[model samples]
Target: MIQEKRSKRGALLGLAASILVLVLVIVLENTLAPTSQLFVVLKKGAVYSLVAVSMNLVNGFTGLFSLGQAGFMLLGAYTYAILTVPVSAKDTVYYLFGGSAVKFSLPDLFGGVDTPTGLILGVLLAIILGGCVAAFFAWLIGLPVLRLKSDYLAIATLGFAEIIRAIFQWQALGPITNGANMITQIPTFNNFNITDESGKVVFRLSAFFPMLIMIICVALIVMLINSSYGRAFKAIREDEIAAEAMGINLAKHKMLSFVISSFFSGVGGALFAMFANNAQAKVYTSTMTYEILLIVVIGGIGSISGSVLSTFLYVACSEWWLRGLDMGSFLGIKLGLFRNGFRMVVFSVVIMIVVLFFRQGIMGNKEITDLLKPRKKTKEVAK
Candidate 1:
């Protein structure tokens, strides 16, 4: 009972802290310039946070070394783009194919495209649908690929991702996928902003939009990780033989983990499309998988909190903070070594250093709440 109370208290505190941070984010969004660097970093960071955490769900928590995240994300991005493109714009977007194969957009089906309610409902449903499509594919692929172990499994998934990418680019699928062409005109993060009758911006919720989604999704994943199913996953991660000996169904749990991870990864892909304002088959490649894997490694394989923190830090450094290095200087110091692409070199070295010194990552198997918990007090004896 005492332990349960502590758990409850810690949860409450965490919830309260999250709310406060969100409120602050809202205030800052309104106060900052629309073109501020913070928005750029926040938008991309939020998207990567979801993807990284989703990858960690399987690779970290489930001890599965799958590398098909990019493929699943590609499914999600295309699914979202194909479903959410406005009906009127379909012809223009797919003009090369004489118009899109699909007849209606989700927004148009649910409500008129102009209505705020319809737009929100349509986008949310499309994103969720994207995840569903990814999850379904995960189920299909997991049946065969999950039987493989370690590096072999990784190679198989990687191959699956490459195959998906190639298929999406085939000329035969041009009507549906645009066939090597980028899918554009999809609704984006800024679409969530409120505008006046005169077309002037009123409220800025663009940053809040992705952030809210990330929080909700991450919270759901955390809840799942704390449940009995999660414990079973950890057991399999620790030792498949031991888990099987304990009567745990290895296949069932492994499939569940793979599906869940791919689901969120798909949603993340949808968000990535939103962030980039377009989806191209070529964008989801092996390099993307390696990038996400790098993040999972740098953040620590089993720590969600670490993933979240490291994503923001990674985005800020690569996209915003270190941008000056590309221009020949950073922090008012111009060095001969500082030039285009120099930032990445520095970033890579820093990552190598972190990996070398802290192999378990920033948090290892711990959550943010673990750090927030107050240290227990020890009684002192007095004369």
Candidate 2:
């Protein structure tokens, strides 16, 4: 009873703290000097956090080692880009296709290109459609692919992603996908900007829009993980044969988890495209999926908080914040030893140290609250 009360209090505190942090970020993003590089990293990190959680839902919670996140992301990014790109911009964006096969734009269909409200709805719809398309593809792939176990499953999923990439790049699909060319001018989070009459910044759109989207995605995953179905997933993860013997339908549950994961990965991809200012099939490579998997591993499988935390760390250290490693200066001194790609070299070394020393990862399959408890009591609970 006492432990339960402590846990509840901890959760409440965490919630309050998260809200405070959200508000603080909003204020900083809008009122402070135009969105800083740090804010850019944070926004990107939020998107990554969402994808990592989705990946965790399958690979960590469900004990599926699927490696098709990049494929799903490609679907989402392309769907979003193709739909949200301005009709006026399509011919130019799809110059390679002579004229895009998709002559009608989603924004125009919804009155979005001409009006603010429609623009908002259309952008939101594009994001939703992106997820739906990815989920549909996941369903198709999951039908046969989900039957495989372990490494075979991983290979099959990875291959499916490659096939999807190839299809998107094919000439026959050139009209819709632009045939290996990048889809640009898609409505980004920046499109929702609210500015002053004098063009002075008021509420920054880019940071908050994507942040809100990511939060919603993360919330959905949490709800799913805590639901009764989550228990079935956990059971399957522990022992699939045992779970099946106990009346669980392994196929149904696996398919559901896979579809859900793919949906969010697609959404994340769309946000990533917006951040990157373009979507190209080449950008959604296997190497990118491996990076997300590395985050899940570093964060502790089955630990959502771990995934979220590690995402910020990974993005900050590896991409944006650690640029100093490549620069000549360090602190107050000029370091001549540091050179190009040093950030990645340092990132790899750090990952190796984490893998070797922190066997269970940063959070180690535990919630953030678990860290708040007495170490002895937490260890007791783990045992």
Candidate 3:
């Protein structure tokens, strides 16, 4: 009993220490290093970090082979864009349907509807509501589909994603989704404040603000995964039949994982939308889903820390390095043949290589903590 208590205390201390470190890093980045190169990396890396973390919940912990993450993301993105963008912008015209002039109006219940508070509240509400709706769909789909084996599950999820794309492409949902026409003129979340001409902020979405929220989400998920429910999820992943034999409810756990995963995906999607300035809806293709899956696979399936690390690397490569790659400067020889798709080709090759050689991926199901076991001391010093 004493040993068990000590272990529990140690775990609590470790968690607290981790959180303190994260807080300190965030504070330092925002206050002393906002314009530094590292801060730029963190800012761009945030989106994929959210994606990888959420993907880890479903694909890593729950052992689900879902490929519909892009679809759910698109849902959250479009929902957030529609809710947050000012209705008076010309881009709003493209989002309208039924040949009617769409007027921007906020519900009276939210005090001072014209103010920034009302807009922010509406955006947040939309994100949560959209996430709930997506979770419901995830549950609905998981009930029938999670019964299948690996390949079948992948195919089914992929088909579901394609179906979502088709629905978004349909003109029927135009009033809400705006079909294929690009939604534009979205006010950035950072720009959504009452600012003076000199831009001394009345309100601003500070760089640290989103990071704080992301940290909260990460903490919540880590707590969930450490709970009894998380143990059941692990059991299922190890062996479904054995988990069932142990009196664990298979269907319940599967649905729960799917719902939770979808919920987080939606939240990440909303953040992406806000970050991207409310870009219009497009048919979510396989590329987006595959990219996220690749991140999870490369990071190490079922390892949250690995996922987070790899996501930062992946986004950095894509956003900063890949885009800035100058093909002409290689080996004192111009290789201008490489075009815009070069990075994607390289990314695919990397995935294939990782799968072929390092099938377990970067951390191989072990978290960063697992790699840091204390060293045993030798008695030779006494001599």
Top model by lDDT, which number? 1
Name the TM-score of candidate 2.
0.92
Compared with the true structure, what per-residue lDDT tens digits does model 1 show for residues 248-327? 99999999999999999999999999999999999999989988888878888898888988888889888898999999
lDDT of 2 by residue, 1-383 (tens): 98668756655655655666577668877767763676777778888988999999999999999999999999999999888888788889888878777777788788855467777788788888999999999999999999998999999999999999999999788888988788888877676677667766566766878877887788778768877799899999999999999999999999999999999999999888888889999988899999999898899889988898898888887666677788866555667766787778878887888889987888888887666644433221110
Clashing pairs in 1: none
Which runs of model 2 end up more than 4 angstroms from their true locations?
Answer: 1-15, 196-200, 373-383
Query: Looking at candidate 1, what is the lDDT of residue 306?
Result: 83
Cα lDDT, all candidates:
0.88, 0.84, 0.67
* Model 3 superposed RMSD (Cα): 5.8
- State model 3's lDDT: 0.67
Query: 59, model 3: CA deviation in Å?
Result: 1.4
Global local distance difference test of model 1 = 0.88
Residues 264-349, candidate 3: write the lDDT tens digits. Answer: 77777776776666544463577888888888888899887777778778877766666534343434545675566776777778
